[model samples]
Target: MQEYTQEQINQAESRGIEISTDVKEQLFEYANLIGEKEKVRALVRNLADAVSQADSEGVEDLLDDARMDIQELPDPTIGKLELRDYGYMEEDMVPLRKEAALDYHRMGSKIYRLGSAGSKGEYASKEMIQAHDGLFGMESQMWERIKDNNLDYAEENLGAFQEPMSVIEQEEALKLYDAGADIYLITNFSSPMYVTERMEIERGPEHYQMSMTELERFRNLEWEMQKYPQIQSLKEANLLLGTRRTFGIYQIRDD
Candidate 1:
């Protein structure tokens, strides 16, 4: 009979799965009865089923079984590529998640720019001005470091801006996009009309106070900035400012 490592047993138990002596014996007997290739196929199928079903207990049970079988098998190798092919790895999802996050940030910056544009020479709430100052200061510091080819240090200071959207937010954003709502006006900025439209679509109001047309302008400028590599470089480094306020920083690529 094969013995499972303590870690394997603990992992199963942590997911509220019980691996009784009977289950252990059954696994060992099955392994002994099957060819190695058949055993690998069976285990892979079981793992896929567990993942598709979102069954944590089933996953833990299968992992424990695989660990025990691997200990006894002469050829106990599984390649990273194989695991990825089996949908057990999420390495490919990282870039998609980052892109989604950047899209969300761009929308927020559009709203902010739109609201600020209409208020030229008008007194902004002290609180709003203070928030802008804080953001501007941080961007300036980051730009200085980036200009010096010290992106590693600049990245370290960008923790606040790098926050990714939660799963719920991502789903909500997709739903709005699918419903024919403008991406720029989805959750980023707020105006009375935009707020009404957003609440109708999302069943809630976002606190941003920006207009849709101005946000459209912000989006246009952002796209235009990409045509000039030097301008793009300045924008990426947070050194570029809009006619009214600082154009928001571009997303940092992990290259």
Candidate 2:
């Protein structure tokens, strides 16, 4: 874990932001988890400065960047392995998988940067789709040409359009289906309704729960956001638009 210098701690304290030892420890752990301990510390300092200056936009931007950094960090153990070794392919096709992964990451990064620049709605969606289609087209052409002798290689190289299946994914899919959830392709992510449904429940106040109608509305809102360019851009940028649900039924339950 990374340790913050006393000077850094003092700087944050001077800004009226209390960085408790526990909080610092948590930040350190999170940074280490993402293999970005130093970057995380720098972000914390930036955040403190932003807060001290009452720069809401700066704070939000810094936080958003930090979130992106964390999200982009591959699991360390997984990061060291080639696609074939990572179980994304059955044959020795590390080069192709690496190239595809790089392209996929580039696409995601480009979309994120655009969103951060305030691109929203239809424009954002179009750009995102264009990027996706461009990559998919290249991969599809390659697959069609070489699929006979390299089926696994071809499939793995397609990236998000098709993910290699695993036991864990199978179980999770089962859980989503059993919970009356629907699946949607959010960019390249296989998002299930139940995940956001649970997020809504947890984010609500104590004993709060959504009714069937309310849940349906919430789900629809998410779907709509994905379809709309501006909303999708804002969502990708992690901006809190006025579309999230905050109210629900109050009930006590013991599980």
Who wins the lDDT comparison?
Answer: 2
TM-score of each: 0.17, 0.26
- Model 2, 1-117: lDDT tens per residue? 244444565768886786546545545544544433366668678767776777878876876675564444332222212322323322211122223434433322111112212
TM-score of 1: 0.17
- On residues 89-175, what C-alpha lDDT tens digit does candidate 1 reach at each position? 332111112222233233331111112122222222223333442111112232233234333323333323322222224334434
Superpose all Cα atoms of candidate 2 onto the true structure and report the RMSD in Å to 1 decimal.
23.8
lDDT score, candidate 1: 0.37
TM-score of 2: 0.26
* Model 1 stretches astray by more than 4 angstroms: 1-35, 73-255
